[model samples]
Target: MAAEAKQTCYEGSSVQSFRFFLEHSGEHQAILQRVHDILPGEFKRIGAGKSSLDFLGVGSGGGELDVQMLTLLQSIFPAVPITADTVEGSSQLTDNFKALVAKTTNLQKIPFCWHIMKCEDYEKQVKAKGDMKKFDFIHMIQMIYYVDNLSTTIKFYHSLLKNNGRLMIINEAANGGWDILWKTYKKELCVDAITEYRSSGEILACLKSQGLKYEEHVIPNTFDITECFNPSSQTGQRLLNFMTATDNFYQSFTPEIRAGILDLLRNKCSTEKDGRVLFNSNLSCILVYA
Candidate 1:
């Protein structure tokens, strides 16, 4: 680890918190490109022609993903006006975000235009900007789950775009993560939908309701949740140790429940004998607006 990373470089600095996670994990560039790949080259040509651009992080998290996106924006547009609003209902992650902003060269270049707000408030900002129709791009990543009404949020995002602007949606490899979690756990996510996650069909339905033109693709991809570590092979204990470092699966459960969850997760991960445990993930990307 670098000297700064090893220390509490920005422990109390809320802004840098999100930046640290991305840099520490070395995931910023990779995930940024993954989301970037969803947009065709044509979108850039279209975006380049615009006078100003906006990125509305539906749930603009404070970590790696945010940094990565900002980096790409700098790379592609360099100095075009980018006013990004990362709206979140809760400010628990603000410190992380602050730390990230402090250290990130790209983020520092642009003014930190965090609303510390919610999607509903976006309309006010949109109105103030002239029209809800003037934004270049509006994105909601892993945040639609927190929305009380998916259709309403979708409509809101679409409303923020100029005729040629873009709206992007990204979620985990599986929309079914929510479904699976809900089935197994009684605790509910914030989404008003009884369904845990939105599928491509579900997302498309939202787009159509808003009368927005859009594109969809099954972005085939995978990431080893444990990175190169394998619990069953020579790295087995090391992998377990890495997981142990964090609270991991124990937070949500009683002692017995946690033990059972660990056994299941670990067993599914690998065994004492042969192959390494490899996990697969799917990242879905949806492009809307222009």
Candidate 2:
């Protein structure tokens, strides 16, 4: 009998695996640092002539990046008060965000409205309110893969932007390791329940199809995957689970499939240097102007 396929990593409790991935992967740090450098110039184009600013964060896990963005906005428009709306599905992550906000004295000028629900539900709530609330800046980072309808969701968020507003999206680059993995093993690994993988290439195509104007920026990143080769390593197993979007991926699949995946991950998706396997996990940032 075949083994039963498990749920996607994000479908259940995913904070630990996600945290482990973030800690081990250089992707997040690279993206964050690049954003910090570029966002000030970008902020100048948004919220112009407005007395206040509104920011929205979709799938705002832990809120570390969100807070940094808010701080940057505050610096650029120091006198303009900011209102931030955070949408997150995980209670633990939401609590972490709230705790961070409570302790951060610098965020005093930005008032937060927390919505402990999925982005889909949050959209419904906003629409049901019968008030068209526009925002100055909205960011959806590393979280678009889970949305039910990518195009519709993108359009909905874009519609919520004020004139001269900016909608920023960051996703895995088309040439990145995640994209390569999904392209090769999607049939074998991806399940029907999840929108398993999406890349900036697809997003760019979607925007082009809709006649939307946008700017693209690529940030190169890498993560050490040498631990993933060790079968007994707990961290390795967790990384494998996140990479495959499967629970216990090291043990769940047949030995042949597991071996093949490991081989591909080592040889095809990563490079070897100094006895370490570094995975190419590049990211792309797309800025859509409204």
Evaluated with lDDT, which candidate comes out highest?
Answer: 2
Residue-wise C-alpha lDDT for candidate 2, range 138-237, written one tens digit per residue: 9998878777888989999999999899999998899788888887887876674354568898899999998999999998898888999998888888
Worst ten-residue run, lDDT, model 1? 1-10
- Regions more than 4 Å wrong, model 1: 1-30, 39-43, 121-133, 173-201, 209-211, 219-274
| Per-residue C-alpha lDDT of model 1 across residues 94-179, encoded as one tens digit per residue | 55677887888667756565666656666567768774434566667655544557887777667667767777887543433222
lDDT of 2: 0.82
> What TM-score should be assigned to candidate 2?
0.93
